[model samples]
Target: MPAAIALARQLSDADNKGIRLDSASLTEPGTPAEAFAVQRETLALNGWLTAGYKVAIRPDGSSVSAPMAHITHASTSGTAGFDRPAVDALEVEICFVLGKDLAPRNTPYTRETLLDHVAAIYSGVEFLGHRLDDGSRSPALLFLADRLGNAGYVLGEELPAKVTEPGQTYPLTITINGDAVFEGPGKHPNNDPVAAFLLFANALTEPVAKGRIITTGSLCGAIPTPPRAAIAISGFTTLTVTAASTRED
Candidate 1:
């Protein structure tokens, strides 16, 4: 059996059983491409559809991305779908809804052209969770293959098109059950969402469809969160959602 598919079987089992795997026994992906291949297989084995994508930049300026299978809008009330809620932490981020398809091509996409493909920009939060026992301490390639610990996401309101301009920042605050947790500037990594999104889009081996959402890395970093806490993140606009209360033993 191919290593990617073999490893994906174990991952799918772990996720379905609601338990973490012993990472040392699993096949380790040697490169980012190999890791992504495993991710594709895992998604297929688990019967999860790709809802969108998430991109993040390392301190060294290189980029990494993962697929998100579940997404929720703020306007939708309730916490039923957020089964894994940020057991570790949560992050505030800028999310974009694509207006057009970004098909794989011989020529790389330009930043200006990519921006034109964006339909709207929104404020949102990313819920972080992992299926590895070692959690964030797991091997980098293995972690990447596991979809970068992306449990789920909740998107807030749409912002004006002008907010997509470079160097834009929001004076933001985050609260849990009405208590202030993070209060400061909400900025995109390196102050450029387009650059981050473009790198992920162009690297894709498959096409990304219109209306699919893509979120750049966190601006507020990861803040520890309580299970089922009512979270409200406010900035250019306000978004509130209740975290999932149920937790695994």
Candidate 2:
């Protein structure tokens, strides 16, 4: 087993005290592929079930993905619970819920072909967390190995059919504790958020099951939040999240 995999298992172990690791202690992966392999091993060692994935796009247009475990689902009631206080970065994103299975194909899927599998679109938030002591400074490969700092996700209201059309941009407004913190237009880097879904779909070698949720990258970037903060986004859909202290039980 790779040293990184063992190190990741230790970081993800729920039974262990919240341990922080610097990059030196957990050696970085030599390549992107190696990092992804380490992620698979981490999930296996921790016995985490794949609930879905989170996709992030780089400046050069390449994308990286991390599988979200079942435990990462947060309440839609605008409140989220965390076990680690060190990792509380928040990201507002667009989420897609699949209605049907998209079986793996020999060739890549086109935008339209991929959209046909979607059941609904949602406004959502991704809670960022990582085991690395200095996760913010970690390299892309090391970050990917840590599941791209994804700790959990909160789903908002389902978007209207008209707004779900390809290439349409949605106005976004983010508020923390009733104060507007961010307001802007939101659109996937690919011009269509579903394109990111298709990219993820084509990359998979196995069929994606129905009802699997895929969250596209952040819109207003990752925002910091206070322990008792209440976050809300209004535009395509209204969504809210409240941050709570870490639970020991």
Measured by lDDT, the strongest candidate is 1
Q: Indicate the worst ten consecutive residues by lDDT in candidate 2.
A: 78-87
lDDT for residue 226 in candidate 1, whole number 0-100? 71
How far is each candidate from the true structure, as Cα RMSD in Å? 2.5, 3.4
lDDT of 2 at 55: 79
Considering every candidate listed, which one attains the maximal TM-score? 1
lDDT tens digits by residue: candidate 2, 1-249 = 557667567656621343456777667788877888877887888677777889766667676788876333445554444444434578777788889987889877887778788898777777776667666578778888888877767776666656546677778888988888888887655666665676778778677789888887777778876656777777766766666534222
Could you give me the TM-score of model 1 versus the true structure?
A: 0.89
Stretches of candidate 1 exceeding 4 Å from the true structure: 58-62, 76-81, 85-87
Model 2 error, position 184 (Å): 2.5
Candidate 1 per-residue lDDT over residues 190-214, each given as its tens digit: 6876778888767777899998899
Question: Candidates' lDDT values, in order?
Answer: 0.78, 0.71
